[model samples]
Target: MSKKETKIYKNVWKPGTEDAAKKFGFIRPEDIIRKNVQKKPTSKIDQILTGWGNYVKSHFVELSPELKAESQKRLEICDPCNMRDRGTCSTGRQGAHVVTGKLMKGCGCRLAAKALSPGSVCPLGKW
Candidate 1:
C-alpha cells in the first residue's frame, strides 16, 4: 500500500482497548487502590448552612431584633459556624466582599446584622 493509504488504514483499524488487552496482556487497576492525599472532613454546620441565607432572604422579612436576648442567642450560634468569619459568611465560599465601600459576606448577609434582624430565621435552625 502507498504510505498515505497505509497510514489511513492504520488509523481506521486501530485496535480497541479490549482487543489490545487480548493481544498485549493488560490488567485493569484494582478498584480499592489507595491514594496518598489526606483531606479534612467539612464541618457539619457549614454544610447545613449552605444556601440558607438565600432561603431566608426570600421567605422572611428583615426586622430589627425586638429583644436583646434573641439577638444574643442567634449570635452565639453564628459565632462558631464554619461558614462564618469575623462577621461575614462563606455564602459563595469567598468569605466576604466590599460593596458601596462596605464589606458584605458570601451568603449576601453578615451574621451580626442578620442575627439581630427580628424577622430573619436561621437557615440551619440553630436559632
Candidate 2:
C-alpha cells in the first residue's frame, strides 16, 4: 500500500477490553462512554433561570440583524465541536480559553437556544 492509501485508526477504548469481555463469554454493547464521571452539585435554580430568560428573549423579543448574524456564527462554531452531543453541549471534555489560553469544559447548554441568546457565552469562548 502507498502512503496515500494508508489509514490510521484511533484507539478509543481500553486496549484488549473487548477481547477480555469475549473471553468471559460476554457481548459488549456499543454506547458512548462519558469521561466526566464525578458529578458535581450544579446550581439548578441558576441554570433554570438563565435558560428561561434566554428562551423568553429569543422568542419574544425582536433580534437585530447583527444579533441574528452573530447567533448564526456561534452555531457554526458549535456544529463541528467534539464537545457538542445530541444538540446539547457535553461537559468535561477539554477545551481552551480563546483569550487566556486556559483549559475549560462545556457548560452543558442546549445549542439552539443558547446560540440565539445574546447573553449566552460559549464555554470555550468561541464567540
Candidate 3:
C-alpha cells in the first residue's frame, strides 16, 4: 500500500486586537509583500532590523523611550531557531510556515511564533 499525500492548511496570522498592533510595531502583511515584490532583501537580520528602524524613524515620530525599551526587549528574546522544526538543524529553517496555498519559508522572527499576537508583525511577506 502506498502512503497518501496529506494536505496542509495555510495558516494565517490575524490581528487579535488593536493593542497588538501597537505592541508589534504594526506593519501590514500586504505592505510587506508589496515591498518584497518590488525588491528582494539580501541582508541579514541585524541589517534588516536597522533598516526597518530607520524607515520607521523617518515616518513616525521618534519612538518613545518606553516603546524603544520594549522593542529592544522583544528583539533580545527573538530566537528564530525554535520557531520551526526542519530537522536537527534549526538555524536555516527559521520562520517557515506551511499553509495550504501560501507557503512562507526561511523567515526568522517572533512574527512566526504563535506567541505573537494575531496582528503581530509577520516576518514573512504576504502570500
Model 2 error, position 44 (Å): 11
lDDT of 1 by residue, 12-101 (tens): 444354455434333223311321234345454443353354336535755344544676787787787766667765565432222234
Clash statistics: count for each candidate: 3, 0, 6
Task: Assess each prediction's global lDDT (C-alpha) against the native.
Answer: 0.51, 0.67, 0.41
> Residue 14, candidate 3: how far off, in angstroms?
28
lDDT, candidate 2, 15-94, per-residue tens: 55655544543433432233244445446455546556765777878767886788789889999998898888888687
Off by over 4 Å in 2: 1-63
**Model 1 reaches what TM-score against the true structure?**
0.36
TM-score of each: 0.36, 0.50, 0.25
Best by lDDT: 2
The per-residue C-alpha lDDT of model 2 at residue 21 equals 42
TM-score of 3: 0.25
